[model samples]
Target: MDKEFFTPRTLGDAIGVSQSSLKRWADKGLLNVEKTAGGHRRIGMEEALRFIRESGVTVVKPDLLGLGSEDLEVQEDELSSADRLYYALHSGDETRVRSLVLNQYLDGRPLYEIFDEDIQPAMARIGLLWHDEVSGITIEHRAHDICLQVLADLRFRLPRVFTKGTAIGAAVPGDPYTLPTAMVSTALRGEGFSAVNLGPNLPIEALLDEAKKIKPVIAWLSVSHLRKAHILRTEIKELARELREQNTFLVMGGSQIHKLRLDRDPYVLIGKNIHELVSISRGLVANIPQSSESKGEFS
Candidate 1:
């Protein structure tokens, strides 16, 4: 049996919730689970964290598996759209949330509504809900996983010609949030570019190696979280300088860029949002006259 499939009763026990409640949630599709042949259900730690975030309820582990009692406390804060989405996520209603966004899109709702109203707010609340704790990390991972899944599903095919001179990439350094990178990748695909995503905590050397191999026309660096700003910036600056010599455009953005004062580095450009980034990329493609477009190979 795969170790990943090992039954996870530990999470439920940690939360002090009855197996029945968890099963009921799974049945309603409000909780996600996996079942074994004998009909035993298993849950994920991510789902458990989401549940705690939405409920804002504390669980005091009177017995920490074998150690002493653990006291868990929850905090109250003014809820935002992000929090509402967190609740939905904890409830394991990915389908419902996706349906709502898709329906709005079909009804001619603006992209801004889908992002600003539907997605961004939900992200904010998730952050606040998990401000501190190991469980917060679990919620963070779940949020990123769900967002990436949604973005992948939304990426439709593009015209063949549009792929001739364009490339896209995503990187998370400086504690950047995952949603922005995933969101930008989706947007880039929608605009007819081939995108490559190298997720969080990527080392600078690995980034350089990948870029050299893939040789993307442009790369995106997201900085939603600022915890590692200086270190990430310094490494990225060095990489950008090196990559520029090879003719790659390094673009960056996220909350940190907006808040911090970063010096001008010609090789690096910051985008305010997805629209700006796409427009910039399109311009880069247009600059390379038709005859020059065929030289760069896509990986």
Candidate 2:
């Protein structure tokens, strides 16, 4: 899913409107806007699509917003699903959420595809709603709980056919987000790895210690927050150096990873999404010789 948020200028450029006009719409409650901690206005992709649909605005530069003309058609088909799921989540309607998610899964979509194309985008929209003050913290928490439950259920249902190797994944310290790690772990498992997800807020030292103990084929660190990028870079570099010595590949990803100027390390793989992470994990597992003691199994 495209998880990009945009500035008014970028949105204006894409939709062929003046920035002042966009701001005016925001002020008139025609467009929803979120404010950053520093008070800069931000717009989510879903909201942009909504505005385009409702106002009959032509999106001339869809690529500037990580979308295409075809996406507008997709928006027409899937927007209602996303909208219903959002409202169901806010109202704590687990059954409806489950039915909607399961309908996609039962329609023969792969779990990873569902996560990347549907669930993640839905969550991103809900997150923006929270940021825009259209939803409360309780609603956000409830939505997360439902999402985790659905993911867990899907993980249990995935066929364990390929048995590649073992992988350990975690969110970095101070990054207390869970869904990204869960997505990584599920993607690894789908690729036939014995995946262990040490979810959110794990200190670097502790993660390194676990890596040493498990001797995994891949160690993944996900960073979702951009605050303290310098500290995270230092910790990640150290972890990469240590994992390199152990011949354990390190995979790092998340929305905020692009902000860091990381050194070029061949053993350290950077993934922008779950699909990339799964591809990297498959490649690493394929090239590395499995230890005699290592056996792949669901954990």
Candidate 3:
């Protein structure tokens, strides 16, 4: 798991500020901190990130926060993060991949933006490796696993609290790709939903069964590689109908989503990107009652 909290000195060091300055900010209530049982101060990642975003401070040492190294400090367009990520993934450098992702995340970039602008573009290029023969396929699979690792690290960095109602998702059977559904979970989490990723390659019947059991506020299906379009269409239609009956919105997306040729149903939503999915989910979450544990600092 990635580091979650930081002391005033550590955060100051990470951002190139003095402890005295950080303490001063805490004293002024500009930065929030919690005291340990022994009296030392600790800053949660949520608060530290908030302070950075609101104050426009540069993260000079994001690695201390489990993000990335000095390369993260460089301003964009020199190589472009997507380009860098493509090369890193192609080379199967898991550490570099993790750093690139965590750096953007701790820098307070939105999960949706990161997916749309960086990870997806890089992975799309990496996907071309499938045609490059067995060695290429091995590299592509390795890249996929590395990305999953980065997502896990990012998940750990998020606060343990999730006050929003449940938001569940999965990839239908034959769509073995996992990143899209996992990315959906992270984005919805960012929007304050308890996003439950049911994972990939689940049969439509099994997906419907789980959706019924979870009774989520919203359900998502990622269709990266669809098979038997007609059967899937029928299954998806039934899923949408069931979700609508429960007042749960059904959101679907992926490169192959259009193959479903979905019918006109108000509860059925089709998104072209993570940004659109989050936008819709955010609105749905607004109407659902927050759990008893919800707080002003909810993330």
Top TM-score hit: 3
Candidate 3 wrong stretches, greater than 4 Å: 1-3, 73-77, 160-163, 286-299
Candidate 3 structure quality by residue, lDDT tens digits, 13-98: 99999999998988999998998899999998877876886688988877787665747445444788789888889999888888
Task: For residues 1-299, write the lDDT of model 2, one tens digit per residue.
Answer: 34458999999998899999998999999999999899999987656655765577766676675543333334446566566667767788776677566445544555667777777777887776666575567688889999898778666655554377678989888888999999898888777888889999898899899999978888998889766889888988999999999888999998887887789999999998887887787688678776655653544
| Candidate 2, superposed: residue stretches over 4 Å from native | 1-84, 131-134, 160-162, 295-299
Question: Best-fitting candidate, measured by lDDT?
Answer: 3
Q: Rate the local accuracy (lDDT) of all candidates.
A: 0.60, 0.78, 0.82
TM-score quality measure for candidate 1: 0.58
Candidate 3 C-alpha error for residue 62, in Å: 2.6
Error of 3 at 171 (Å): 0.3
Candidates ranked by lDDT: 3, 2, 1
For 1-299, candidate 1 gives per-residue lDDT tens digits of: 12232234565575677677767777897766877779987654334444544455444452432212412112224554345456756555666445444333433444445665667767666666566777776776677677666655444312222464445555554454567877776666545566766766556687788788867777777776666666766777788888898778888877677654567876687888776776776777677554455454443
TM-score of each: 0.58, 0.68, 0.88
Ordered by TM-score, highest first, the candidates read 3, 2, 1
Off by over 4 Å in 1: 1-90, 105-113, 131-144, 156-168, 173-176, 258-260, 290-299
